[model samples]
Target chain A: MAKIRPVGDRVVVKPAAKEEVTKSGIVIPDTAKEKPQEGTVVAVGSGRLLDNGERAALEVREGDRVLFAKYSGTEFKLDGEEYLVLKESDILAVLS
Target chain B: MAKIRPVGDRVVVKPAAKEEVTKSGIVIPDTAKEKPQEGTVVAVGSGRLLDNGERAALEVREGDRVLFAKYSGTEFKLDGEEYLVLKESDILAVLS
Candidate 1:
């Protein structure tokens, strides 16, 4: 698999698949599922360049499970696997 | 007029009106005109908070004519005047 190194505070995440089961055990179709906003950080960029020429450290690290904003990030496929590249700010929280 | 103080690297801008004239002097109607991407800064936030707890100085200041990304920012009206509030990153360049 090719390694992806995001640039400038961007992160590459592999989103978790949306759950297809309902509370009553009904299987929802793919079209009815919402896009997953949760993902695991696969890679992180160095940091965002600050106005003072310093790089702001990223709060999330690789292997961290994170929740990002809905409809954020660019999606792409690498080696038949899907990934998303988004800025650190797009990530709302790091799941414990 | 009520004063608006934007918060957290956000800026309030009064957008320039879109041009209605073509090169050949044809007038475009309001419905056909694209949204203007240029504006004058009316207010600015202190700055974006950095990971180190320092605020990053914004490049655009109040009264600066700037170009910003289209479809960015929230639109609001104050005292019947229209304005846009957008983050500094949404501003593309400062007009000289």
Candidate 2:
């Protein structure tokens, strides 16, 4: 498997599976599907460079489930698996 | 004037001015204005709540110039001046 280590405050995430059928029995089309906002953190960057030359640590860690903004992050395919690279701030909340 | 003190990791930014003409001397209309990617940090939240129940300090500060992603943050007008409420993560970089 190819390894992908993020740089700076970037985080690698595996998004949750897309829902085929809605609760209302509506089959959403692919083009109409909304962007997934939840994912699992797979990898994290060392830290972001602060103005004072300090490295600010990332807020989320690997294996943590997080909720992010709708349009956040850049998507990539690695080893046939989809992943997202986003900043820690793009993650809205961490699930308990 | 109304005060807008951000909460958590939210920040208030004043965007850079829009350009009426392009470099090639082409006039651009207001409706064709692209979203501003740079701004000045006006106010910031105390800190973000960490998973360990601690507060992680914000990276940016007041009066700092920053670059942010387009389509990020909520926009509002305070005292007739436009401002943006964004998470620290939305801000991509700080200019020295």
Worst 10 residues of 2 chain A by lDDT: A20-29
Docking quality tier of model 2: incorrect
Off by over 4 Å in 1: A1-48, A51-96, B19-36
RMSD of each: 12.1, 11.8
Name the lDDT value of residue B41 in candidate 1.
Answer: 87
Model 2, range A3-92, lDDT digits (tens) per residue?
Answer: 545646978788776561232233334564554376789887769766554578898989887777657766554445666668788898
Fnat (0 to 1) per candidate = 0.00, 0.00
Weakest 10 consecutive residues of candidate 2 chain B by summed lDDT: B20-29
TM per candidate:
0.44, 0.46
Tens-digit lDDT track for model 2 on B1-96? 137789998899887774611221222223322322657889999877766666767878898766566589999987789988999878754544
Q: Local error of candidate 2 at A1, Å? A: 34
